[model samples]
Target: ILSDETDPNRLHDLKDTLDRYQVYDSAQIDELVGLYLSGADRDQLDPILDACVAAYNVGLDEDGQVDFKGKAKAFARTYAFVASILP
Candidate 1:
């Protein structure tokens, strides 16, 4: 899904999935943004920033905490996955 989704509609679907699963948190989203911004070049940063914002826009809870317990672990795993792929 990640590799094939190159447009806003597909990305929005992915964000909806994350929201439905309640599998990520604000802090995790912030960390993802930080990771992308830290290493991405100017050209690569835009999409990463957009993805981060979209993910957070859908996934963050009203209280600003993770919606589901233990989902932070999933966020950590996702972070590691992205980190490994990044330069």
Candidate 2:
């Protein structure tokens, strides 16, 4: 599923999101999707997620606006529905 990336500029923002602004902000879900577009030797999803989990702005509390588990479940449902419709 690899394709030549036409958006190198956006990929460059990954480090800033993770390092520079993590104390005050969380990386957007769409920003994380950039990992696939990065074409790096190994996907850094696990480490990135772990880092995000540790980030102060991610707010894992029950009333938090950012919900990693909820996002995962939503992705699962969307993927399942799309796959079911595809074939």
Candidate 3:
């Protein structure tokens, strides 16, 4: 479990609650979201991107990076859930 732009103590608390599962800080999570968003199919990113857009209500960076607080949590959940289910 991880959270973007979340306090490190709170994130540590969350990880502790989840059997001490490793929790990534915002910066680490941002990288994952960036990679996923950049390489994934546009269709796959649509809902996530839309949700981010709705949350931030701002234009992306000139380099085309979407910036939104806590957006990485969604990606963390996606990765966590998928990884948990797969062998």
Candidate 4:
């Protein structure tokens, strides 16, 4: 998952990897985010959703659900968005 960090390598790199791999599509991403959000610690999904919003300009619902449609376009847009924010 992507996050706010003080590390040398930006978490955006990981999102890039996922994009390059084409493994985690929107459905998958939504599922994972939902899984994380469903817990008591919903805040844990904040940075992750921020990453998605950065990349896709799409925010999670108030209930923390990610729309899984248009997986590639959303992911690519989000990927570029996050990449732009890095460094």
Q: Which candidate is the best by lDDT?
A: 1
lDDT of each residue in 1-87, candidate 3, tens digit only? 343443435544434443222233454457558868689766665665465455344444432332222334544564565567558
RMSD of each: 11.1, 11.5, 12.9, 14.3
Instruction: Give each model a TM-score.
Output: 0.30, 0.35, 0.24, 0.29
Q: List ranges where model 4 is wrong by over 4 Å.
A: 1-9, 39-87
lDDT of each: 0.55, 0.48, 0.47, 0.52
lDDT of candidate 1?
0.55
How many Å off is the CA of 68 in candidate 4? Answer: 23
Model 4 whole-model lDDT (C-alpha atoms): 0.52
- Global CA lDDT computed for model 2: 0.48
Sort by TM-score, top down from the best:
2, 1, 4, 3
Model 1 regions more than 4 Å off: 1-7, 39-87
Candidate 4 backbone collisions, by pair: 55-78, 56-78
Alpha carbon lDDT of residue 57, candidate 2? 46
